[model samples]
Target: MAWYATPGGLSSLSAPQLAAARRSYDLWSSGNPGLASKYSFDSYVEYAQQRHAESVAETAEQEED
Candidate 1:
């Protein structure tokens, strides 16, 4: 699956947010101008939240060991 967002919209994101998005979605790393743009800020937030939760869970599991 691919994720897409407008260049204008992507441009509005903070550097950290853009970095995170690129990290999350490998396809975005290619520097493609605009192809099948589908994501919005909300979607990015959700993705970030999920990653946070997973990280928290991993930490908790590690602590239990």
Candidate 2:
């Protein structure tokens, strides 16, 4: 099934929109945006947290080997 967002939110995106979204995510994630952009502050934080957790879990698994 196709992905979706909120009713009045970004439920869908075009090619350019997807590219811009990716660029926006990459930019805000590098500690440069400083949580200033209201568009993706929370999402970016959640993405970073998920990445951190995955990295931590991977490291733990590696150390156990």
Best by lDDT: 1
Cα lDDT tens digits, model 1, 1-65, are 11233223355556776666667555542454253156544555456556666777899999999
Error of 2 at 64 (Å): 0.3
* Model 2 misplacement above 4 A: 1-39
Model 2: lowest-lDDT 10 consecutive positions: 1-10
Task: Give the alpha carbon lDDT tens digit for every residue of 9-34 in model 2.
Answer: 23344556555556767776575656
With a 3 Å backbone cut-off (N, CA, C), the pairs that clash in candidate 2 are none
At residue 49, give the lDDT of candidate 2. 48
| Number of the top-ranking candidate, with TM-score as the measure | 1
